[model samples]
Target: MLATLLGLDHLVIAVRDLDAAAAEWRALGFTVSPRGLHSPHIGSANHTMMFGEDYLELLGVVAPQPHNEALRAFLSAREGLERAAFTTTDAAAGVAALRARGLAATGPVDFSRPVPLPDGGGAEARFTVFHFPREEAPAGLRVFACQHHTRDAVWVPTLQSHPNGVTRILSALVATEDPAGAAAHLARLIEGTARRDGAFHRVATGPGRADIAFAPRAAIAALARCAEEALPLEGGAGMVLPTRKPRPPALASGTAIIFEEAA
Candidate 1:
């Protein structure tokens, strides 16, 4: 079969403080990768927590540039689940598919970051990405598709093990004015289907991938109370929640997280 939308690839949290964010996730028991620097054109840096089939990225703008203009604005408003990327085997094909469906998907933009290897070496983790129209996605949230060219440089086994035993992102909870509309838009972007259940609209990415639920703020805020804590953009942890700074839907801004444990 030709390339298809794989599933939820990773969740992105934009933080004003990358080092502090990295330290926080590490304290939460995740083995985050060393900071990866993007090309000058992008002017961003990140650290990632690798999982079996997905990961979570903490991104920050280290320099001002045209490419990260939207991201900078996101950080200004709040720092929390800003974007979610879908995995694709072929980025060009994925963009084509989205266009075929009448969505104005853009890019097969390629970039790379240097990764410091455990064995005192380094490798470049390269990627190609296509973005769904910003106006089409929920306000303050970005959705896109990604294709990885250097899996080994990324999905490093050592980085996949977390002390908390959290395995992967289970779901994302988004609070929006129109749950069904938001959920349907995201489902279409990921090549999934959405179903409405009362105040929530749920989008399941695929088998063994993250699910997204769109709901009203009150409905999502109720779930947040059960969590140990929530950060606007830093709400990713599993099994054992963070030792400090927790989430509630309001704190998570537009999206809250639901994690899984299999340590």
Candidate 2:
């Protein structure tokens, strides 16, 4: 059986300073886990936050060796939630399918990370990640994914407490320059039902769903125009995620997850 495409695994933000960002998330209530450094085969060094089975990672550059041009470019863009990632069961097959759809991708490459086990020991799990190559003006918000080896561990977060009300990831907003083309490309790459409505495309999967929103990066300025509220951060981007009940911020990372009580 082909590895099933699971829901979102995690989201990563490429920040300017790992220490500062991790500190911000901790003050907000998340038990930001220990930070880790990844090498060549793995990629950049990262500080992580766990939220049940899902997580949010803050990645930054330490050295420029083995240099990844893409990662370097993202860092140059200066601070913000950088990448949105989905989880899959099989990396190899997933990449193949994506290619068949005409989207250029990389990896299914062997990816591994060590997690601190509850028993005080650490265990390493292997996985794969497939990513869109360039962060072009047209594909800045391009989609990517991860597939992990399931050996059963005591890390991650409890699904019940996920902050996003994400009943199954209704969809995500991907702002890209070529909304129409990106939507069409995604429609073919993801083996799911999709419908386009102007600049937004809704993608539906068996147990998960997501919306890809296309817009130029310049549009972030509009978001800044919103009224400012007293958020946890002294001065940073913030928003509330409404849920069925009032709960503390589910998890914290560079981009903290906010929860709201259902109205």
Best candidate, lDDT-wise?
Answer: 1
Please write out the lDDT profile of model 1 over residues 1-263, one tens digit for every residue: 11467788888888888898888778656788999999888899999989889888889999999889989987787777778788888999878887887888889899999999999899999999989887766534578888999999999988988776667776666666677777776765665789987887778877788776777666655565543334332222111122123332223223344333233
lDDT of 2 by residue, 160-225 (tens): 243334222223344445556755555555555557664444454335323344433233223333
Q: What is the lDDT of residue 181 in candidate 2?
A: 71
- Model 2 alpha-carbon drift over 4 Å, by segment: 1-4, 65-67, 135-139, 151-154, 157-171, 176-182, 195-201, 205-258
Q: What is the C-alpha lDDT of each candidate?
A: 0.72, 0.52
Clashes of each: 9, 10
